[model samples]
Target: MNLKFIKRNIFPLVKIISTVLITSAIGLESWNIYAFLTNRNVPSSLNPIFWIERFAMTSHFIESIIAAFYAHSGKKMPIQYATYTFFVGTIGLLELFDQEND
Candidate 1:
């Protein structure tokens, strides 16, 4: 088996899948929020769960903004990134192939 070729090709697939998963999650969440906004029967946005989610998302947004600034300075991340915990499995590629930057 050609391990090197498979190794080289796997990350792009992982990235594309991760991105799709993340996008779908966001899309689903948007639909939820839209339903809440449009239907008075839905729970209030001020619910504790919503506040907790808001804080979590805000923290993640801050990290991405920082990472974007770092990217602008031509310094790549020293570690791998994943959009969600499910995607973290893809980080194994870093250890398997020594691709820590990008």
Candidate 2:
């Protein structure tokens, strides 16, 4: 197995999957908030997920800011990297690092 080939192909696939999964999680968290606001009954099992999702969202926001800073320092488009990092988290940051390396 060639390492470059795997990094070029598989890494992008991983990023796409990560973005989808994270976005879906945020969507679920949004629903949880809406449910709570509308006085809907939320299951006890989901209570834990609600808190976890909140933490994840906060972490991702911070990561996005870091990504923007990195991109700006590298003379790349900060907004693009920041938006991508917001959706894909660390995977997007990894990609930015890889681009810098290249």
Give the number of the best model, judged by TM-score. Answer: 2
- The regions of model 2 sitting more than 4 angstroms off are 1-6
Q: Over the stretch 61-83, how does candidate 1's per-residue lDDT look in tens digits?
A: 55544443444234344233313
Pull out the clashing pairs in model 1.
none
lDDT of each: 0.49, 0.83
Per-model TM-score on C-alpha atoms: 0.45, 0.79
Model 2's alpha-carbon lDDT is 0.83
Best by lDDT: 2
Give candidates' CA RMSD values in order.
Answer: 7.6, 2.1
Tell me the tens digit of each residue's lDDT in model 2 across 27-74: 998787798899998788887877787788888899999999999666
Question: Would you list the clashing residue pairs of candidate 2?
Answer: none
